[model samples]
Target: MPDSQIKFLVVDDIRENMVALEALLRRDGLQIDFAGSAAEALELMLVNDYALAFLDVQMPETDGYELAELMRGAERTRNIPIIFVTAADRDERRHFRGYEAGAVDYIFKPLDPVVLRSKAAVFFRIGQQARELECQRDEMRVLAHHRDIAISRLKAHADNSPLALIECDRNLTLRSWSKGAERMFGRSAEAMLGQRIAQSGWLDAEAAGILQTWVDGGTSAQRHSAEIDARRADGQTISCEVFGSTLCDLNDGNLSLSLQLLDVTERRRAEEVRSLLIGELNHRIKNTLANVQAIARQTLRQADSLAGFEQGFVGRLQALARTHSILSDMTWSSASLDQLIDEQIRAGTLDAARLLRKGPTVQLTPENALRLALSLHELGTNAAKYGALSVPGGEIRLTWTYNDELLVLRWEERGGPEVHPPARTGFGTTLIRASAGCEDDGVSVDWSASGVIWTITLSVGVAQPNQPDQERLIEPAKIESGRPELDGSRVLVIEDEPLVALDIRYELTAAGAGKVDIARSIGQALEAIRAAEIDVALLDGNLSGERVDEVANALRGRKIPFCFVSGYGRQHLPQGFQDAPIIEKPFRADALLPVIHELIRR
Candidate 1:
């Protein structure tokens, strides 16, 4: 007899009959689960995979007919075959009714154990065949997709007419050369086809030696690059950057090499002009920095005494430091508009109390965050010194909106002593606008007697979806002793943080884990999985700097179920890793218990 791995669900109101059927099926190497009612059976089906279900036709609430109908309604359990175990007489009406209720076959009591085993074997074989065919279809689909992408890339390269395309065999025999190659080297494919490239007239003595060394290796698998001057067919020398690398067959066993030759003379000449301009720009920046530093020193030195210097020089330096801090927060790039305003306004100060900030979340890339932060600093400083924030009962409102993909941020102030425009342009205005200049997008400001208003519109990248919170389900009014059965299975805990690892270990043990093993690293986790059978695992996304996906794959390879517990958002989770239960960081113990039991039963 062949060993069978098919699982069967045994549903019956009578516990004795269920046990008898289980005993009979055990001889055939079938794993079985016994359910007292159809509702219990359906709940089992939701989380477990069984080749067939032996459902009793008549039972308490939700008999086999109602149970089968519900199963058919659910996408996850619709495919499981149902075999009716009933005492219904052999009437055509009852037979038709059973078929309508999604039963594959109906059996009468007193049951024949031998006949029941034979019928189940047939459906089990069918399920295995269906699974195998699906796997094959998926493999073919992946192969076809890769082939299409390769063909598309090849067409793009061919149509663009790159500087030169060279194709050679294992022995350095020229097989194909493109038109661009002919124009660059003054040699046609018709003249070079089927000829040894070493015998070609292009290479000089030193180049020939290098080419021969590469050819002696059958084919140079790694890229070989060199800049060399070679005489064309007309005896005029041209400088080219030649690169060669091997290509392997996508399907069958075959190998070849392709070389590309690029003409870089024009680009090299342009680099010289760019270098001169860059040097002049650098010198101008240095000169400007020196002048600004001298002016700052002069302003402080001309003050009456130490107290004046502290009041003048120290304030400006602190403002500069605040701008620098905001820039650093953005990694020296753009900062979010709201974050800029919040950071520049001291919490206990009038600027903070009078400020009103409202906007959707927006992120500035490094350069923009810094510029926006500096501009925001100037606004906050001016308000503190003279505008709304400087007076009692003053107010400021900052609002932003996204209209048709444009990010518009507004800074409006009011409720201060009647405002007035500055008598003359000052360094504050220069620095504020200069910071905005870092962005290609234009920035505009309006200074009014009532208040100062500034608005800037810039492009912002779209945001990805946030991780979904746990689903809410209605629990049974009162759980009977047999209410929802928690799985009594082994669990593995893989977390590098010792505190987190111990917490998971304690919870699993309290949750009735028969055996719980803790692994702090990827290597240990794999070893634990291999040495002991695991029913479920709770893994951290970063275990010894390795992704939890690696642990997931190992569990999948063994047909074990596992869930991830990560501080990182679901977006950071590896692909194909989400469907399995994920408990986000700071999850409660109660939430994890249900998922563990669900996956375990699966």
Candidate 2:
């Protein structure tokens, strides 16, 4: 309520005295209630909250001291300030009695208006301050009520959440555990609370140390998150993503820790599987591209014209692509040898019905599948162009049998133009002979007057069941006379993917680069730049979500040339780096070597 609404009481038997008291206390915003007798004053005091009271000491029936005593006895009026007014002369004994009766001051009349007003003003201000204190107290109570409700709601939510919530003290002693924690850890709050986190044997030493550091630092605002292994009640280790933050205890204002743990065992396992698959994919892609490169080089070496080279290269790539598709459909594990032969024959011949094929159910590994598919494609192409399939009634009999774990396959042609062995070795011939193990006398070609008979006997080990064996046909080229030479030059490679980074390191090392340094992120790259004297740098455009601009700037400041290698386009590069050479991903040795040589020369 507004201060102006505050009321004061005045009691006296004489009308003149009551008027005098009211007038003396009168001021703007001052409310006065007049009562002539003690009984009447009691009634007014009961109904209205009075700031101060004036009682006449000599009233009939009940005197000022008696009325003051009555007001003091009541709960509501006990705290109200009282001043006694009397016409009789002041005596020490009467003053003591007045004070004993709860009178704050005794006034002897005829009263001095100045002294009375001064004392009344003092009481008025005191009453206003008291009311304000009461109002503030009420507001505090309301705010505290709301805070309690909010805390209760949060506790309810935390209890029901899937993430475990655990609160610990500075000593890493568990203080509170949510229901979610109990469910996640398979331990009850009663069992875990007040136990040292380390003693519980759930968190590993490293994880425990991390939590200890956070607690020791008293970093309430800073959040720390990490993936760690935590042992459950059943002693099974599970992967958990833990988020730690500091919280202040409302009761004691002491620093404590709140840890939220999310069980990510499945997620971590899935990520491991995905990473393995990605590594496998990278290896496969590298191998496939290398194969394509070899095919192009070999095809180009024997092509009579550019058109011939294009035709041969495209046909080889198509054959590789089709084989890849089939392997992909089978999850890259194994493919049916008979199915592979049929598909290749159908692709090359419109009269596929005329072709004879016989084979047992045989599954070929990815490596063997790809190589065998290419060989079969080459054979079919040859038959269609110059051998049996060139004539309408021509017949190509392909048969295979497995004995003593050896696969014997024969491609015999008949009823077509006379055939002769090629005058010069071609890519098709090389691929077929190499794949069939002709170097080991595993394959033979006999040119007869009727047709060409090519027979191959390979151990079943050549067609590995599920595992893709390393190719024996081609090996990655190393630094040679024609390749770019870095003999004594230092090179820095910045890439996040481990496999890609390793590949870059291998390539640089093979090119005779000395002291090749690899950094998986921008921070590491910057550190490497500071420590090493780099001649040239190959930086992935994105390093773990951070752009390599800072590293690039550092390299530029050092007058060291750097190139960007990324799966993204040049447009995705940071501004000012567009001028830098960008080699798109899946780059070959020929493409990468030239860039490196140019950068080193610059």
Return the TM-score for each candidate structure.
0.30, 0.56
- lDDT (0-100) at residue 399 of candidate 1? 76
In model 1, which regions exceed 4 Å deviation?
1-5, 27-29, 126-238, 241-256, 260-602
Task: Give stretches of model 2 more than 4 Å off.
Answer: 11-17, 27-30, 35-48, 52-126, 149-167, 178-188, 210-228, 234-282, 297-310, 328-331, 336-350, 353-363, 395-430, 433-602
Query: lDDT scores for all predictions?
Result: 0.70, 0.81
Question: Compared with the true structure, what per-residue lDDT tens digits does model 1 show for residues 346-458?
Answer: 32122555666666666666545545655676677678778888888887787777656667778788987677777876655655665545464546778788888878766
For candidate 2, give the lDDT of residue 424: 82
Q: Which candidate should be chosen as best, given lDDT against the real structure?
A: 2
lDDT of 2 by residue, 219-322 (tens): 64589888888888999888899999987777987888889999999998999999999999999989988998999999999999997887677677767776
Alpha carbon RMSD to native, model 2: 14.0
**C-alpha displacement of 498 in model 2, angstroms?**
30
